[model samples]
Target: MELVSGLFLSKRIVYKNGTPVPLSVITKSFEELFNIKLGDCYKKHESVISRKPTKLTEFLDELRKFIIEERENKGYR
Candidate 1:
């Protein structure tokens, strides 16, 4: 028997400015925040989606924290 799973992929990032950030930018930000090679975050997200059931909000919240931490670490004003 084949087990089917629902894979969650972020279609887009909806910013507070009511703008839809492009996938390219989201991917790039993730890379910068995590200090990972370009495209690594996308691969990791895909792997997580395949392994578990994750909510979109939960994922975004975690990503938000990472972004904030990265900025603080970089001393971004």
Candidate 2:
């Protein structure tokens, strides 16, 4: 029997005030804020409907924290 799986993929990103915020960042933020994680989705590199993730959720939290930490560590102001 074929097992069911998922593939989650998304476009580059969404903009707010013309800021090129990566989609991953936005998703990461949501995943952190509400502790929300989704499972696998059927996604492929080329194809609109072929966007999905294998795991519904991610273990990473504190999306903002991570961003801050990265900036600070790099001494980017």
Candidate 3:
């Protein structure tokens, strides 16, 4: 949820028409795709922004670590 929120906030993604995607649409797509109910994405985004140390990117940091480790293990570096 944090990652999705970050992506939305960053404006790194958009519709083909070059318009920003709504947060609700993004969150809803993620929920349906993952088959997981994410209650109150706005609150989750608030928590993510308030996270200490990582400062709104805690989940992304963890994801980067895991990806790096996997790539190293697979000799993809």
Candidate 4:
């Protein structure tokens, strides 16, 4: 949820015409793809923003770490 919210907020994911996608649309697509309901995506994003110790991008950071670890494990620079 946090990852999706971050992407939505950044506007990095867009339509072919370069229009910013709506948050609800992105969230709905994610829900359908993941087969799980994310209730009140806006509220969840607010909670992520209000995280303690200024770790707002916790999930994104974790994802980066996982990708780096995977690359290292595969002997790829």
Clashes of each: 0, 23, 0, 0
Better of 1 and 2 by TM-score: 1
Error of 1 at 23 (Å): 0.4
lDDT of each: 0.52, 0.41, 0.83, 0.88
Q: TM-score of model 4 relative to the true fold?
A: 0.82
Ranking of candidates on lDDT, top first: 4, 3, 1, 2
Estimated TM-score for each candidate: 0.33, 0.28, 0.81, 0.82
Please report, as a residue range, the 10-residue window in candidate 1 with the lowest summed lDDT: 1-10
lDDT (Cα, tens digit) per residue for candidate 1, span 20-67: 655456667655777866545455555545554455345556778999
Q: Write the per-residue lDDT of candidate 2 for residues 1-77, one digit (tens) a residue.
A: 00111112233344666555544455455557778663322231133233345432222325557888999999998
Runs with alpha carbons beyond 4 Å of true place in candidate 2: 1-17, 39-48, 51-77
- Measured with C-alpha atoms, the lDDT of residue 51 in candidate 3 is 77
Residue 31 of candidate 1: its Cα lDDT? 55
lDDT tens per residue, model 3, 14-76: 899999888878888999999999888888777777778746676688999999999999999
* Residue-by-residue lDDT tens digits, candidate 4, 1-77: 77888889899989999999988889899999999999898888788878985687777789899999999999998
